[model samples]
Target: MASKGEVHVVHLYPLQMSIYGDLGNTRTVTARLARHGYTPVLHRHHPGDPFPEKAHLVLGGGGQDSGQARVQDDLAVIAGRLRELADAGTPMLMICGMYQLFGNAFVTVDGDHLPGVGILDVTTHANAKRMVGPVVLTTDFGEVVGYENHSGATRLGAGQAAFGRVRSGCGNNGDDGSEGARTGNVFGSYLHGPILPANHALADALLSYAVPLATGRPFEPAALDDAIADQARTRQIRRLVG
Candidate 1:
């Protein structure tokens, strides 16, 4: 059990992954927790490290195909544990490659299939042409702004709740207006401008889920001055819209 004011945030595969400033997500999480008066205990899990037994939140970031391949086996080993955490209501934010790997499977452009952890009922098919640009999404939390760069087009299972509706840019796939998938406390998305820094509402939602599970009490973090974040989001949304 974590001590009072101590929240454990596990960063999965930080060394092997985190392409496109994905590590910034972890920094954002830590900063938010600290601002809310909680001590964020960051646990970085490398290839060989065992997954921590107690985690309030888990963050996984975007990676390239080669990076994904390198960590696939290690990820497979911990897949079951991840499912357990999800069942226990631990908040998870999986971005890009990590999001694909959390699903059923990802088929590469070369036709090789990479087995996923099956946390989300989705499948990704790699395309020769990559989708790379600023993305705007209207989510339950609010308007989310980020950038996406991926070759995988992910399709959610029937009846699965999407993280949001795509307002602009190619989401999960260019075909569906749906962007990302959410199951319970787990959220998977291709949005990779580190996500949380600009989308503070989504960040707070993740924290709302985590603090309760970690501290054995419901928590609503004190609101911070988000004017700058809002401005950044507005600029991104405008760029995407224009």
Candidate 2:
């Protein structure tokens, strides 16, 4: 497979949504892309900036409710462009706060309504107690794991499909076994182990979709040693499962 000369990676609201090592996902993606012989170009899209004209993979991180409020209007400003990208099969990974905003709306405890981009068929409400802990999930990528700390209970719509099923810990909502929302290649989850570092499959899948879209070249992955990450992931999974 031919390598893409470059893949544009867009990171939204990095400064505001850097909670719980969320920025690690961006770092991990770039690092992994390098190993695959592709140059990863990063573009940071803050509130009011024009959405990058070039984007292969888009990422967003976790943040507090307050942070979400701060980005609410800004997200609205770029929602249309994001929706367009999603429809075009540009891979997107939205965690926690971003995940909530990508939904229909996020209802605060005070009955305040924060509108969302409606990319995912889901809604979040601040009613359930905070669910914070390590999580293990059964997904199409096999076993995926991460950490989640959020009080905003999310519910997937009837027409929606979950990103994975929770095997342990609260996911989406305390009542549902679902862990995240999925619309085409757009994925929304609360996982925060900088997520990509702990889940290689997810990261690689995003890159596979990205290279072709960005440079019209198929993604040819190289075999890189992930022994350290694999070992760490194994220990965490064991601790959680045990």
Candidate 3:
């Protein structure tokens, strides 16, 4: 357990996974926490490691197909603990391959089914062609932009709340307008480019959940200057729209 004023963050599979610049997401979380005066104590977990005793926030990132396969068995071992954390309102941000593995299962193009943690009520089908490009989403937090590169087409189960509606680019699938899935404090998205840097509101929202959980009281983080991030987001949006 974290001491008061400190947040325990679990970074899962940082070594075997995180093929796509996904490790940057962990940096963003820590930076945001620092700006808000909370000390973020990171617990990095690799395959075969014991699950952390407590975590106010958990982060898992995208990986290549091979990387995904490498961590599947290890992930399954901790699936029950993850589900319990989600149910208990711990905040999580799972990206790309991790997002797929958070669901019921991910069916590969070769017709093999990779068992998932089943934290999200969704299923992913690996397609031959990848969906790679900038994506815009109109989420409850507002507009968010990021880059996506994945071949998994995920379909949400009944009663699943999408993280947002697609504003541009291929989302969960080229067909569905949904871009990601969210249940309580758990967020699963395909967006990369180290998602939080461009999506300040979403970052703050995650912090809002974590701070309260860590400190046992509500917290409203002080605003920080996001000028550079906002400028980059605008340029990306323009390029995607134009």
* TM-score-better candidate, 1 vs 2: 2
Model 3 vs truth, CA RMSD: 2.2
- Show how many residue pairs clash in every candidate, following the order shown: 0, 0, 0
TM-scores for every candidate against the unseen true structure:
0.96, 0.97, 0.96
Better of 2 and 3 by lDDT: 2
Shift of residue 93 alpha carbon in model 3, Å: 0.5
Estimate, for each residue in 129-155, the C-alpha lDDT of model 3 and write its tens digit: 789998988899878999899989999
Which candidate do you rate higher for TM-score, 2 or 3?
A: 2
Candidate 1 regions with alpha-carbon error over 4 angstroms: 1-4
